[model samples]
Structure formats: C-alpha cells, structure tokens
Target: KLPPDDRLAVLLGVIFCIPGSRRAAMDDSEEDDRGPDESPKRPLKGQACRHTASKSSNDDEREDGANDGQERPSGSEGSPSKKKSRDNIPEPLSSLHGLVPESPPRFVSLEQIMTTANGVTNMMLAHEIAMDDTFKLTKQEHPEKSLEHTVKKILHQAFWQVLEDQLAENPPNYDQAMQLLQEAKETLLGLLLPHNTSLRAEIMEGLDVALVRQQAEHGTLDFGYYARLLISLMARMCAPVRDASVRDLLKIEGVVPLFRGIMDQLEVMKLDMVNFTIQEARPLIQSHSVAYAREKFRAYLETQALLSPGLDPLVHTRAWLRRSHEELRALSAQYSPDPVLNGRGASGPPFAVVLAKAYIQLLCWDPSWEYPETLSMDRERFTLLGAQVEECALVASVLLVTHSVGGASLQDISDFKEDLRSHTRLLLQGCGKCSEEELTEKLKCAASQAIKEVQESLQKHGFAPLQLSQERMLYDQVVSMASAEHHIRKLLTMRILDFIKLTLSSASVGPTKIPAGLSTLEKELTQIAGTFLRLVTHNRAVFGEVYTDIMAQLRAT
Candidate 1:
C-alpha cells in the first residue's frame, strides 16, 4: 500500500484536477455500459471530455512507442523541447510513477470497501433527491427560493451538520466525501482566485467539513446540491469583480460593444418614454392653453370695467393655477412610466408637468409680500414680476417646441394667437359691436405693428442687419407657437430684453441670490440655456446669422 503522505498528495492532485481527473474514468464507465450500436453522448457545455479521451489515446500510443524504442517525431533535439514535453504531462500522473505498484495489491480491506460503498450510496441518494420533479416545480414557481437558492442560504447549517456527523461517526467516509467537496471548492476557487483568496479559503474549509459530516450522517455525499451552491456562490462573488474589471477596461479603450448595446437600449427607452408623455399631454396642453388665454382676457376685461382692479385678477389667476396644477399632475402621473424599472431616477416629471408647476408657483406668489402698494410699480418690483412672467413663457415655449406636441405648427400657433388677440379688439368694439373676421383683422394689424416696432428697436440699437433679420425670423416662429395672452407675450419679450440689459449692466455682476422655491425652475432654465448655447455653436454653419445673433445675445447676458 502507498504511504499515507503520498496517498494524501494523490488525493490533493485529484481534487485539483476536477473535471480533468474524473473525465477519463467517466468515459471508461460509459464505454462499459454502452451496447455495440450505441453512439457516444455529446459533452456538456464548456466541457472537452471527448478531446481529453483522444489526448489520452495519443499519450498511450506514445508510451507504447517509447517502450518499443521507436523514434518519435520531434520539433527539435533540444533541452527546451524535452523540458516542455515533460512539463506538459499532468502532475497527478507524474506523481504516481514511483507510488503505483507493478501489480495490484492482493488484499482488500472490508472496512474501506464498506465506507466507499456507503459514500457512493449517499451521493446517489442526494443526486436523486435533487433531481426530483417537485424540486424542479418549486424552482419554476419560485425561482429565487429554489432548492439551489435554499442550499446557499442553509450552507452554514449543512456544513456544521456534516462536520459534526463526520467527527461522531465510528468510521467516517471522509476520503470520498471530502474529495467531492474539495473538487467543488477547487473549481470555485479557480474562478475567484487572486481577488478573494482569503474568502475562498474560508468557504473551502467550511465546505470540506460540511461534506464529510453530511456523508457520515446520511451515508451519501450531497455533491449535486453542493456543486450547484458553489457555482452560484462563484457567480455572486464574481459579479462586482466583473463590473470593476469592465470599468477599468473601459477607461483604457474605445466604446465596448456590450456597453454600446446597453446605450442603444437606454436611448430607445428614453425615446419611448418621451413619446408616450407627449402623446398623453398633447390634448391637456391644448386645453390648458385655451383655458389660460380665456381667463387672462376675462380678467383684463374685468380690470378695465372696474373702478379698481379689485381681488378678481389675483383670485382668478390663483384658481386657474390650482386647476392647471391638478390637471398637469394627473397627466404626468398617467404618462410617466416607473423610472426604477429602467435603473434610473431623478429624471423629474415630464416637460409639460414641470412647466405647469413652475407657472403655478410663479403666478400664485403673494405679490404684496414683495411689492407693497407704495412699491408696486418700482423698478425692483417690475423686474422681479417681469422675470417671473418671462420665465413662465420661456418654459412653456420650450416644452412646446421640443416635442411639437399636438402637431401645432408655427402657422397654427399664429392663427391661435390671432384668434386670442381678437379679444383686445372685441373690448374696443364696445358691447359686442364687431364681427369675428373684422376683429381678427384688427388684432392681426396690432400684432404686426408691435412686431415691426420691436424689429425697428433692434435695428436702432445697432443690431447687424443679417443678425437682426434672423433674430426676427426665429422670434416670429417661437412667438407664433406661444399660447399665452397677447399682452403677456409682448411683455415677456420686453422682459427678456430687460434681463439681457440687466445682465450686461455694471450695476451688478454674476448670479443673483434666488429663493428656495424658485431654485428648481431656475436650474431647469439654466440647463435649457446651456442646451440652446450648444445648438447655437454647432448649428452655426446651417443657421449662422441666427446662431451668431443668439450667441451674441446669450454672451451679453
């Protein structure tokens, strides 16, 4: 018999070999079982058992040739080639050279045979139980709570149970059982080595004790379940390591194909979400615009008729803002898909909802708090009020233009604005005196005059002719799409110019202190401005005159 130390070394090598050591034995067993006509079974995924069998045959043929002193093919008659050939032979096979006897041992130990038989029986039982249909059904029903998952969870319990049983047994089947577990541990450690050597070693020790204990208790090794558990643990352990590796690799390289696929998917998801919100919000947006315009005009009419503007203007605006908030919130909730599903958050609400919320907050602010009666028309008061108004208009215009919701073209917006402007002439027509068509013409004339005056003002201020023309064209396009009251539109344009003037003025420089409530809206506006700046820079080639003017204007601010 081989000495205990040499035998242990052989066992260690066997454990280390895993599939390589077991494959030849398994193939031999299958050959013995096969009928004359039976074809070979295909190897499982990532397995090269058949190749190993072919390689073993080649090795045997070489050994036979060497025994007969036949000359073999050689790349070179060199020390390096001889050394490489010797190195290529597996350590386990080489270690057996002096250890294996010329003839098989004559005596068989009854105790050793019984222990091995019992271990084999235990292994068979565990494999059979693990392969039961109920386990498969349970796995299918609750994948996260499957036998495989449960095994991982109860790993410590199973390990201790096996360890205690192994220690308690009169004659434990530690050799066979521990070999099975060592094979699993070695396989897992191979994949997780270098990164988590200490962790893997601890797990291996626990696994070794558990396998021995379980085999001692049940008379069969739980190799199937334990193998699966080790595989799962390897995957779980490797996931973060894989991600860190990917990030490091990415830093050194161009775009990875896998990441490109992920980006493509993300882009598709973003587009789908944006399109969905636009489709849902279009009708609501149109109704909101119409309602706002109607309320503003009605309030204006009341103000004109009353001795004092009274509380009606503020009350009506507050009521409209509240109603708009509710409707927009409902629209957003209906259209905005769950962000977590896409592994993202903090995207905020849809564009329409954001604008509506900003509008409501701006309009619902108590003017008296900042502007008492004495200071109502002061420059500071007008600046703050005008800035808020301009912000609302700007946000609303951005929402409209970005999505082109409701298919509202510039012409359609112009027509809609023209219709709203008729209200001004209607008030002048005195007690419903004018026709809709006649009022429309008068409203059109007034709007044209207002636009012409603004253009002239730009020219007077030394705006380049080409730049001014382009600016006017873009303004017309944007203003035509605006759904606010005509007075609001005019005042908004003026406030923008005022803001530009303030920004350029030597009175104050850098950003001004903003209130907390206005911070969100202000941040959004800054982002929008940055986006516009980029567009102006990149598209200068196509819209050079317009972009040049816009750039000049933005830079001035």
Candidate 2:
C-alpha cells in the first residue's frame, strides 16, 4: 500500500484519467495504427504527466482502521519542512488494477479536481467515524429544485413511465421488468451471507428471470404476484428500524408504483448491509489499530525524509516536553542516584505521566509555541478544552471568593450562584485565546459581577449589604484574581491540577474522587480530565518509544 501522500495522489489520478484496464488496451490499438516515426502526443497547457502508483483494494480501508478513529495529517508526525510535498506536483495516472504497469506516462485532464478533493474528504470522514459503535449508513436525501423536490420526483416519474408504456404493448414487453428483476435479485443476494443457503435457494427459485419471461410469452404475466413476493421477502430481510418503510411498500398498489418502491427499498437495504459489515469489523480494527498505526507512521516518516531534507520533523516534540523534562529531572535530584540504561528512560517519566504532562501543557499551551506534531490529531479538541479549563478555573475561583465574603447571605440563594456562572461564562468567552490585556479586562468585569451577585442576594434575603470597608476589601480580593500571581486563584488552580493528576495516574480512576475547593466544577472538570486522559493514554501507547528517545536525548544534553 502507498503512504498517505501517494494515496492522495492516486485518488487525484483516478478521477482525472481513464481507468488503467481501458487505458492500456487503448494504447495497444493506437501503437498499431501509428507510423514508425510517429511520436506520442504531448501534454498541453494546464496539463502535466507523471508516473502514477496503483491503489490497492483494501488500502483505503486499512488506512482508516490504522488510526484511532481520527484522520491525522501525514506531516504531523514527520513534518520537517514548511513546503508541502504536493507543491507543484505533476498530475498522475494511477494504476488501480494489480501492479503499476511500466506503460508510458500519460497526460491527465484537470477536469475532476473537485471530484478528487471530495473523495479525499469522504475518506477522512470515514476514518474519523469507523470505530464508533453507533455508526450507520443512512440514505442521503437530495433537496428539492426551485424550492421543491422536483428533481428527484421528476426522475423517478419518468423512469417508471417508460416501463409502464413498454408493458402496455400487445406482446407485453418484459425487458425493463426483466432488468429490474435481475438488479433486485442481486441486491437481495448481497444482503445474505454465505451461510444463508436455504434463503439463497428460495430467492433464486422464486424470482427466476426465465420463469418470468416464459410467463410473459404465454400472456399469463402476474406482476402483482411478483410485487407482493418481493415485498414479503424484504419485510423478513430488513431491520426492525426499516419495518415502517417495508410496510409503506406493502401499502402501495399498481405495477409501476410498487416496483418503484421496491427499487428504492433495495438501495436502503444495501446501505444497511454496509453498516452491518462496519460494526462487525470495528472490534477487530480497534484491536490491531495501535500496531497498525505504528507501522503506518514508520512508512510515512520514510517518505517525509526525502521531502523534508535535513530538518528534524520532531523539533516541536522535544520543545513540548522540555519544561516537564526539567521538572522531572530536578525532582529526581532531590531523591537519589539515577538508574542505568538512561537511553531507555529507566528513571524518566512513565509513559502515562509523560502524556499527563503533555495534556497539562495543552491547558496552558502558549499560542506562540508550536503544538507537538505527534499529537496533531487532537489539536482542535485541545484548543477547545483549553478554553473550557481557563473559563472554569476563573469562574470557580471567583465564585469561591464570592461565597466566602458574602457568608450565609448567599449560601441558600441558588439563583445567585447561577447568575454568577452565566456572567462569568459570558465575560470569559475565548478567555485563553484572546489577548491577555483583553482577558484581564474581561476578568475585571467577571470580578465585579461576582461581587454584585453576592450583594444582590444579601439584599433579597433581607440581610444588609456589605459595609463600605468590607465591600472595598472584597472588591480588591476579587479583582486581584485577574493576575496569575493572585493567592486565591493559585490555590484553586492547584486543587484542579491535583484532581487531574489523580485521574491520569490510574486507568481505573473515577470522577467521584474530586479534590476540595473544586466541587462546583466536578462535572465539567471530570469530563475534561477523562477526555484528555483517554486521548493521551492511547497516544502514549502509539508513540511511547518516541517519547522515551526524546527524553533520553534531553537528559544527555
């Protein structure tokens, strides 16, 4: 199988050029008709030629199964250069048959570029969802034309009308009906497994094309009998969810409409079969995905080596773990002498801890520092999680101080707590992403809102508002929370970080074991912790060796 880059190239080639089997035959005929001195045609402007690789039947499937239900860009692991590998690349005529033939390279038209782009996008989406237990293929509904579903309605109507007119003749033509019967039989057979011997025999005997043809010749053609039988077979073969659709087919009357309904139901059943196969294959794919991904990544790196030249593809990786590496080192210094075999990282961080450190970095990741290339599959997810972590931290810490300063006056007021949460969320929108100056300004507003909620709650509960001196003290404490050095904010941050550390330390850990001062955010923090831990655990299993090697190099330096 080709690497991801070449696989994309093959997709581009297939849509733009003739299929290999037909193109080869055409070349042979053209050579026979040409004179001895004749030269082959050259590519014109906006066209180019190159040697194309063949795509294997299972290559795309394997590529999807190789990842942990995510489409990681090929360069994320081995991207050593800024220039893309596909830059100014020539058009390729892919070989989809067996081996790539040594036939002369052919020029390709640029007409199907969008089609190839769409195909690649679909392949990525398939990879991202293949492991989902609830994954199912649903029939796509085409939208109406001119503000109505005229296009689909028109096509179905015209096709059925053709069959009706053909069957209305004196001799009663069965050609279209015969073709429909053949297509239906194949579709039914496709829905069955190899072990379905009895059902297979029944289908073949019941819908025999020869039997229908003979019936037509004798003018005893029973269209109603065939239609009823097809519907009965479909009701038995289809899923329970499709029982309603099968019943709708049964409700239909007349030869034309029934057959039209039968054809549409057959298409739906085919999709169901495909979904069933994916569900059956998911466990096997997931079981072997780790090893498969390792190999796929290895091959990708080899390809990137030629494209990237002398630059190290893992530059960001080393930088990502550099800070954690120093902390772990200094912590080790306070204990004892290090273990031998440093390169294997015997005294270094456990793979789980390494990933935990990486995840923590994600929560506070500097936008200026590039994300680790190895973890690129979850970049967007991390960015979102970072925003949530920052917002939750800010809200929880502010609310804590608010409750303490407001005392029992705000204790029983659930509405007061909710108001604080809403105001905090609004003010902290895009908290970690926007400029620090802007975030500080927003945080100041958040502080004021917290103090206001507490005061409003006290007055509503028939308690006096904070005295002037008390109000000034509470305001100063809350506003100072905007700074990173704020004591109350730092305490809350420490508690949240500790809670995360506990969850990442063990696979069996649960969200129930929340640290003190973070109960207000237990649910949100637990979800973030769980998601981060799961991704890091899987990623560590895939790239633990790489992490070990990088750490050993850092220690040596």
Candidate 3:
C-alpha cells in the first residue's frame, strides 16, 4: 500500500487531469524537463491525511464491506507506491480493472473553487447575440449596422429571456438568485470604483432593476442594499479620473434625466399594494452611503442660483409644505379610533412633518459656496412654515386640555391649574403665538374647557378671581376683542397691564392678606392687576407701558 500523502497527491493529479490523462502526463513531463540542478517537487508529508481518510472510511465500510464479504484492514500502514498508483488510476478504468483504492477523495483550494464559480456567474449574466437568415442581406448591405443589430437581437432573445425567467419564478431559488445578484453587484462595484462612466451607467440601469425585483419578491427592503448601490453610483459619478465628466453629470440640467427616472420608479412603487411606510423607507433613502448623493443634488441646485435669475427657494419650500398638508389631509380622512391606526395610513403626516423639517433645516444651515444668495430666502420661508406647525401643535394641545378638564370640580380645576399653567407657558414660549392678533384668534376658537383652564391658571397664579358672571362677561369681551380687526391691539394691552399690576401688588403684600381681612381685599385688587398685565404683554407694542404702569402701581401700594 502507498503512504497516505502520496495517495492524496496522485488523486489530485488524476482528478485535475484532462481526457486520456494527457494533462497529467504533460505535468509530469514538465517536471522532468527542469534541469538536474532544479529541486524536485516535494511530496506533502504527514499522518494527518491518512488518519482522517482511514477513520472516515472505516466508519462507512463496516456495514457495506460485510455485505460484500470484503475484509477490513486493522489500521496497518500501506506501501507508498501502491497507494500512489491506486489513487492515480482513473475511476472509470479502475472499476473496469476491478481495483479498489484506499485513499481519500481529492479536495481543491476554496479560493480556486470560488474564482471558477464567479466566472460561471459572469457568463450567465453576459449579453449575447443571435444569427438569422433574414439579416444576411441586410448585413451584406450594411456591415456596421448589421453587427450592431445582431448584437441587440442576441441580447434581447438570450440574455433578456434568462433574466425574465429568473424574475417570473415566485420566491426564486435563493442560492441561484443570490449568486446572480452578487455577481451583478460585484461587476457594477468594480466598474464604479475605476470611474468607468459609460460602463457604470449600463451597470447602474441593470442594478436598479435587480434591486426593485429583489425587494418585490422578498416582500421587504433592507437599508444596506440601497446603501451599497447609492455609494457605488455616487463614487463613480464623483471619481477624479472623470472630473470633467463628474461635473457634467452632476449639473442641474444633466441630472434631470436621472432624477426623473428614479422619481418615476418611486411613483410606480408607491402604487404597489404593499403597506410600506415612509418611516420604513427613510433610513434607506437617507443612509450615510447616499448622503453624498443628497449633498451633490443640493449643490447642483445651489449652482443654479447663479445661473437662473429670480429662482425662488419658496418653490421647493412650498412643494414640501404642500406635501405635508396633503399627508395631514389624508390622515384625517383615514382616521380610526384603534391602536392599529399607528400601522397603516395614520403615521404618514408625522413622517411628512419630519421630512419637511429636515429639508428646511438642510437649506437653512447650508454651507455650500453657492448658498449665500438663497440662504436668507430659505430662512424666511422656514420661519413662516414654523408658524403653521405651531398652529397645529396648539390645536392638538387644546384638544388634550379640553379632555383632561372635563367634568372636574372647582377644587380639581384649582389643583390642575399648576399643570395647566406649565403647559400653557411651554406652548406660549415654543409656538411664538404671543402676538395680539394670533392670541385673540386662538381664544375665539378655543374650547370652553380650555378657556376655563386659562382662567383657572390665571386665578391660581395670584391673579384676581372674578365672579362667575364677571368671568363669563370677560370671556365674551375677549372673544369679541379677538374677532375685531381693530380692537385686538388695545384689548391685549389693557388685559396684560391689569395682570402685571395684580401680581406685583399681591407679591408686595405677601402674608399680609392672611393676617388682616382688609389686606385680603388688597391682595384681590393686586391679583386683578397682575392678570391684566399678563394679557397686555402678549402684544409687544403695548408691553412697555403696561410693564411700567404695573411697577408704578406696585410701588405706590
């Protein structure tokens, strides 16, 4: 018997050999051709191969060898030449000659196998052409045209058909599908890295289709796939080898075609019955790998500011605002009083709000060289946009406050006043709704409970407690004051002045009210003035005098 290492080497040579073992013999001859001074190819030496093969064979042979009446060896070492010749013999010829080899199967290096597999994958993806008799005359008349025509004909029939077949199969055989996808991705990535412009475009078109189909078939999308595709495409578009090409491709005029193509595809996908939300889609769209794409696109727009005259930033800003408005309208239409509302169409408006905010912030903080002309315009537009957002926030808060205050007693209202005051102060600070016109308008539309909340908060903060009749009369007066085009300014001034005066006077006479009944009257009068001051300061125009008068009255008292 041959030694195990010799047997393995012989098996490798035989397995790799061409038909008739010509290549194997040629290999041996090539070895021999080396001069005597050259060292001989050393055989791999070790008991590792033998022990492994023997143990595996022994396990399988115990059952099969018994049926064949073959004797199993007891782990004895075999002769080296015997083992070599036995393993080197081709399987078909060995079977014919009734020879059995005591050697392990041949194994190839993993890298070699992977390289071959990748090659096969490429072939499957290659574009092809076909021959037809009808094209013979045409080819003879126009050889160049014929060549191009033939190439396209072959690609459509052969390459396209294979892709169609793969796409048609539902839940594609994962291994085969992944192999093709991987090969295509590798090809595109390779072309992109080298900045091959024309080739990269072709690859990108194919990759886009593959990605869409993959998402559709899988019924889900992953952010990573989109990230890789965007990064590769952006790199090719920006590479130094194609600096001029990159600039041209990224130009506002030049990018329109690509942008339109992508937008068209997005619209088509939107019509799909799948319930994919923007929240689910955003991470993929805004991923770091594609961040450069956004930057480049924005830069292109900025460049247009120099070229195009009177380009309004509001055009894009308005588009975003309209989109958010439409989303909110849709949400209201699909409203449902169920927890599941969080899933379907309900989450869209919030996402739209977030997207609008992000886009606005980007334009507002833009540091690109071309942004100076447009930055002021964008900031003004966003400020106006913020007012709309504030209105929505206030409306929502009002609803919550109304719900919370329902059917509560006076004591409950008193206890809740602090909480109400805190929320009201927060809303006032954040919403920028302190203007007389805005404040009056808000009060006119406010729920009765919300008005009561304001009143209770005012009284609890040491503002005077009006009689119920007097409070109702004041509420009507404020509502009328809010409605009038002319009266709102004066009403706001007087109300705020009264509030500040009341607060200061009460503070000046602290604990004096508890000891003397007459001081209680003084405290009530002070509280009234404080409440009036609070209202007037809501309008900046009247704030100065109302503030001065309140301080003057407190000092006099």
Candidate that scores best on lDDT: 2
Best by TM-score: 2
What Cα-based lDDT does every candidate model obtain?
A: 0.38, 0.65, 0.37
lDDT of 2 by residue, 192-293 (tens): 887999999999999999999999889888888988888889988998999999989878878888888888787777666666765665564456555555
**Candidate 1 stretches greater than 4 Å from native:** 1-56, 67-182, 209-232, 240-557
Full candidate order by lDDT, most accurate first: 2, 1, 3
Task: Please report, as a residue range, the 10-residue window in candidate 2 with the lowest summed lDDT.
Answer: 44-53
Instruction: List model 1 lDDT by residue over 376-401, tens digit each.
Output: 21223234444444444443333233
Q: What residue pairs clash in candidate 1, if any at all? A: 122-219, 122-220, 123-220, 123-221, 162-213, 162-214
What's model 1's overall lDDT?
A: 0.38
Q: Candidate 1: TM-score?
A: 0.17
Q: What RMSD does each model have against the real structure?
A: 33.9, 14.5, 34.3
- How many clashes show up in model 1? 6
